[model samples]
Target: MNKRMTGVMAAGAAVITLCASSALAAAGRESSADMRGVSVLVGGGVEGYTRGLGADIQPGAAYGATVILRPTKVVGLELGYAGASNNFDRSNVAVSEATRGPDVMRNGGQAVATLGLTASPVQPYLLAGLGISRYNVRATAAGFQDDTVGNVPLGGGLRVHLGHFTADARINYNVLVDQQLATDLPSTSATSSTGGIYTGTVNLGSTF
Candidate 1:
């Protein structure tokens, strides 16, 4: 009889131990699964960019957000928006046979879509995206006037996650698709342009 009682107690202890182990493993799995989901973030910041023929545009304010659909631990799709203004600087001068002079400034907004690859929870990533931009140029002699433009930008950047939010810095070499000539300027004046838009951007966002 004593032998039978000892055996029963041993069996009960074994079952309890197995149940505890199972519970711990289940909790660990849930924690890992939480890493994969839809995250929405918004941020406002700045960028330095250029827009038409030669390299000459200044920095301006920019703001935007990214919505990420993370399917796995390392892959996702990010839909983002960014807007920046271009202010002209005389230091951006070109030497030409026509003339050497100051020109107009340009600024605008961009809507973008990117596919990204992440390496960690607080990850640094790379993205290839397309941007739809509306550019406006303002000359000091005249008020602010603008031209609409479209571009395809292939780029990459880094992101840092701090609990509820993330901060990012990115650079894009935007190739303008539509080419518009500014021949209306006085024929004797130097025909310098803003150039293909190249941008360096930084923004902050929070996840919900």
Candidate 2:
């Protein structure tokens, strides 16, 4: 893990701990029905890289799992892990055969706070969080260096609750910081050091 990733993970841990403590304290004053329990979700979707990363990586399939802890009907915290497989765009004829590389695997972890607009069966929510992303590519003759970066994810989604089951459609726009991919291409400037990722997913889960 890079320094930025390590810092994000530490900050996330602190925020989660504080939120959990606050939730426990509030639970004592709230009715059982008003406190939503924990939920686990599994989902898959597509992700597109933008800016620097988009120049070399192709959009691809993404999958993830999430754990949500709702202390109150309208407030919750989410821990999520997601991964995507993206192919290198080799259309650039200037690229030498030796510089060409295999598929790239992108993985990320996030800790987010969510706020629901309403407590009805159908709820719309906003989320913002801190996250870390890692981009791994198999070493090539050109000696590409893998990178890890910290990110901020911001987005919103709608959730439908049916008895103990829930379904959600969510999208997140991730801003990546200090992302340096050391491809060391011959003619072109090395890959961009900053980029963005657009992700959307549909998740189904059960509340306990």
Candidate 3:
């Protein structure tokens, strides 16, 4: 990763830690009715690529589920799983017009620490996490291999609570370390070991 991206991730982590500490301390003074204990959400959206991955891949569909555990009104922990399938750029790869290139599927899981900005029905939050992503190439080509990379996810979102149900819209920028995609394909030029994945999702679920 570049120095700028590394600095951003470090700053975000510091902010999340500070906010979490404040929220946990304030939780004891808040009323019990304001607490949200747990929730689960399932949804689908879209994901785009950046840096090295963007050179040979096209944006596509994404789906995922998330489980949130909140110990206080303003602090929570999120566990999430996401999968995406993107088509390869035919012009960049050595594939003919009659046959499209292989599908690039990415599956990942994350554990994030969240801090809500407010205690209202509509709340905005910040999150930072660590994750592992597996990139699989689904093609008939020989000598191809799959790769797994560690990632740092940093982003924020908005959550709206309606009675016992909640709706959330979020976006995350995943900074991938040691990611290698399309390296085995002929005529491919993306050689950078670091890349990024940009994801946007909306989820709906019940709160407990």
Candidate 4:
């Protein structure tokens, strides 16, 4: 499933890029082929696990770097890596099984499509992407053995550009798509919940 999703995402990204470039060419915006730029972003944010897991996971800080390729002023492709550590929320869930709930090491890479609302310096954009997240959960009691799955991230935000400086803020929800993650969990168990993540971040970057 991960392999198939990756291929579909790559194909989809290509189609979107082609259509965007063609539209820009028809609009006479500096020939999409000739107009190209790159940006490097540094960002930090908070995220949390949501779903039916053995234990409640607390929201935690996350940070990552992203490189953007802008083929046109209004269209860009982004590739990034981010990771966060979440501890089980012991206050709400039962922790008697061991000492703590499952400890998870979440990390992944994402390919995204960004569409700017305008070509101006201060532009608002919408973005959505596909990612494969490795959810390393240590829960011997709940029967969750597998560790990785696909994600659907939906988000939008504003980008402020000033000379070589760029800044942006965004919020997103990452939905996990695989049901087999709970292959070991009993069907009646609450730990068999489908998990997701929510994040909000601000970034500072430089464009060249």
lDDT of 1 at 197: 53
RMSD of 2: 11.3
> Which runs in model 2 stand beyond 4 Å of their true positions?
1-35, 93-102, 139-144, 182-193
Candidate 4 local lDDT, 67-176, one digit each (tens): 99998888989999877666666665444355353355678889989998977655678999988877776544244444677777788876665556666677677766
Model 3, stretches more than 4 Å misplaced? 1-35, 96-102, 140-144, 184-193
User: In order, what lDDT does every prediction score?
Assistant: 0.48, 0.68, 0.69, 0.65
Please rank every candidate by TM-score, starting with the best: 3, 2, 4, 1
By lDDT, who's the top model here?
A: 3
Candidate 2 global CA lDDT score: 0.68
- What is the total number of backbone clashes in candidate 1? 4
Residues 27-83, model 2: lDDT tens digits: 333332233889898887677777656666667777899999998788989999988
- lDDT, candidate 2, at 116: 94
Model 4: ten consecutive residues of lowest lDDT: 184-193
User: What's each prediction's TM-score?
Assistant: 0.57, 0.72, 0.74, 0.69
3 or 4: which has the higher TM-score?
3
**How much is 33 displaced in model 2, in angstroms?**
9.6
The predicted structure with the larger TM-score, 2 or 3, is: 3
Number of backbone collisions per candidate: 4, 0, 0, 0
Error of 4 at 106 (Å): 0.7
